[model samples]
Target: MNRPLYALLIAAAMLSGCVTINIYFPAAAAEKAADRIIDEVWQLKKEQGAKPEGNQP
Candidate 1:
């Protein structure tokens, strides 16, 4: 019984080690997304600056 348990554990460990994870994303898409975010931030800043300030003492 002990031998079988040890064999099962070793087989599980080996199989788990064989797994591989792959992540893929397009560079052009990422660049376009970044540009859009930057443009939005810049536009917001410009709009904020353009607003007239309230009367101050």
Candidate 2:
């Protein structure tokens, strides 16, 4: 029926106004993360030739 079609059109129009999209990129945060990863890799290399601390067999 035309009544249902009109109702569907009105509902579609109402919902169309609610569309929103947002995107964000944090460069400082990404740089900090990369630095931490690099530090961990270096620490592992430094400790590779060192003995483990604490009780061990």
Residue-wise lDDT of candidate 1 within 8-31, one digit each (tens)? 999998777665322445565576
Backbone atom clashes (below 3 Å) for every candidate? 0, 0
| Residue clash pairs of candidate 2 | none
- Per residue, candidate 2 scores C-alpha lDDT tens digits across 1-57 of 699999999988776654431134656567656656876987644344343334344
Name the candidate that leads on TM-score.
Answer: 2
Q: What lDDT score belongs to each candidate, Candidate 1 first?
A: 0.62, 0.61
Against the true structure, what is each candidate's TM-score?
0.34, 0.35
State which candidate has the highest lDDT. Answer: 1
Cα RMSDs of all predictions? 13.6, 12.9
Over 4 Å off, model 2 = 1-22, 44-57
